[model samples]
Target: MDFFELVNRRESVRGYLDKPVEREKIEKIIEAGRVAPSACNAQPWKFVVVNDKAIVSQVARKLYDPLISGINKFALTSPVFIVVVAESRNLASKMGKLVKKKDYTNIDIGGACENICLAATELGLGTCIMGWFKEKGIKNILSIPSNKEVTLVISLGYYEDKEPRKKVRKDIKEIMSYNNY
Candidate 1:
C-alpha cells in the first residue's frame, strides 16, 4: 500500500493472535526505526525486543490502570514487545558548554517509534504504542541503565479482532490557519 493508504489503515491494534512475528519482520521494523531522522544526528535511542513470555508478562505487570487498559490487554496477547529507550546526554558536562536545551533524545526516539509503527503497518502486522507503565519496574526488569529512559512500549503480533473506529478529528480548514493566526 502507498503512504496515505498505510497511514489511514494503520490503527492502534489492541487484540492480537497467538502467532509469532518472524525475525525477519522484526529486523525490518528495527531497521526502519534506525533510519528515522534525529536531531543533530544524535540517534540516542535503543530498542529492546522482548519475546520471552516471562519478561513480557513482567513488563505488562508494570502497566497501570485506565490509561493503559487496552495496552495491558494487548500485552497479554501479542507475541512480541518492543521497548524504546532514550539515552540521556549531558552535553554541558561532556563539552563544558550547553548546546541544545530540549530533550532531543525523547524527540528522536519518538520518531523512531513512529517509523516502526508505520513499517509494521506496511508489513501487515499489528502494533500498539504503550506508555503507561511504571518506569522503575520496567527498568529493573529490563536491566536498563539509569541514564536511559523508557519512552514507549509496543505490542506486536497478528491482529485477532477488527480495528477500533477512528477517533474523529477536526478538518484541515477547521484547525489550520492562514499566514497569521
Candidate 2:
C-alpha cells in the first residue's frame, strides 16, 4: 500500500475478529521496530510478544481499574499483545541526555512504536497502542526486570468489518510553520 494510504488506514482499532495473527507477520512487525533509529543508536527498546491465550488473558486483566472496571476492553479479544519495554540509555545517549537535558530514549521508543503500528497496518492487521494500564502488574506478569520501563502495550489482530471513519486532524497551515513561528 502507498505510504499515505497506509497512514490514513492506521487507526486505533477497538474491535477484532476471532482469528489468530500469523507468527511470520508478527515477526515482520517486530523487525520494523527493531530497525527503528534511536538516540546515539542506543536502540534501547525490548518487545515482548505475548501470544499464549492464558497469558494474554492475564495481561488483559491488568488493563482494567476498579473505577472504570473495563477500560481497553478490546484487549481481552485481541489475539496478540506486544509489550514495548524501554531500557536504560547507553553511555553516549546518557551523556547526550545530560548535555541536552532531554530524554531521547523515549523519543526513540515512540518512533519504534509507530513503526510497529504502521507495519501492522501494512500487513492488514489491526493494532491499538495502550498506555493506561497497570504497569507494575504487566511487568510482573511478563517477568520484566525492574530496571526496564513498560512504555506501551499494543493489542494486535484482524479487525472487524466496519466503514472507515473520516480522518480528523488540524490543518497543515495550523500545525506547521515556515522559518519563523
Candidate 3:
C-alpha cells in the first residue's frame, strides 16, 4: 500500500491472534526504528523485544488503567512486545558539552516509535503504542540499565479482530493556519 493509505489504515489494534510474530518481521520493524532521524543524529533509542508469556503477563499487570487497559489485554494475547527506551543523558552529551536538558531525547524516541508503528502496519501486523505503565517495574522486568529511560511499549501481533472505524476529525481549515493563530 502507498504511504498515505497505510497511514489512513493504521489504527491502534487491541486484539490479536495466537500466532507468534516472525523474528524476521520483528527485525524489520526494529530496523525501521533504527533508521529514524534523530536530533543531531544522536539516535538515542534502544528497543527491547519481549515475546515470553511470563514477561507479557508481568507487563500487563503493571500497565495503567483505561488508556492502557485495552493494550494490557492485547499484550496478554499478542506475540510480541517491544519496549522503546531513550538514552537521555547520553543523547544530551552528544548535543554539546554544556547541555542542560533531556527533553529532545523524548522527541527522538517518539519518532522512532512512530516509524516502528508504520512499519508494522506495512508488514501486515498490528501494533499499539503504550505509555501508561509503571516505568520502574518495566525497567526491572526487562533488565534495562539505570541510564535508559523507558519511553513507550508497543504490542505486536497478527490482528485477529478488525479495528473500530476511524473517528471524525476537524477539517484542516479549522485546525491549520498559514501564520500564527
Q: What TM-scores do the predictions have?
A: 0.85, 0.95, 0.85
Question: What is the lDDT ranking, best to worst?
Answer: 2, 3, 1
Better of 1 and 2 by lDDT: 2
Best-fitting candidate, measured by TM-score? 2
- Residue pairs clashing in model 2 are none
**lDDT score, candidate 3:** 0.81
**Runs off by more than 4 Å, candidate 3:** 64-71, 89-102, 161-164
**CA lDDT scores, all candidates in order:** 0.80, 0.90, 0.81
Distance from true position, residue 40, model 3, in Å?
Answer: 0.3
Clashes of 3: 0
1 against 3, candidate with superior lDDT = 3
**Residue ranges of candidate 2 with Cα displaced over 4 Å:** none
Give a tens-digit lDDT track for model 3, residues 45-118.
78999988878778766664556435365556667889888865454456563564445678788889889999
lDDT of 1 by residue, 37-110 (tens): 87666677789999888887787777634464444655667778898887655544224225433556666778
Sort the candidates on TM-score, descending order: 2, 1, 3
**Predicted candidate 2 versus true structure: per-residue lDDT over 1-181, tens digit per residue:** 9999888889999878889899999999999999999989999999999999899889988875656866898788888999999888789989988899999877898999999999999998999999989999999999999777899999999987565579898999998999999
Sequence-dependent TM-score of model 1: 0.85
Better of 1 and 3 by TM-score: 1
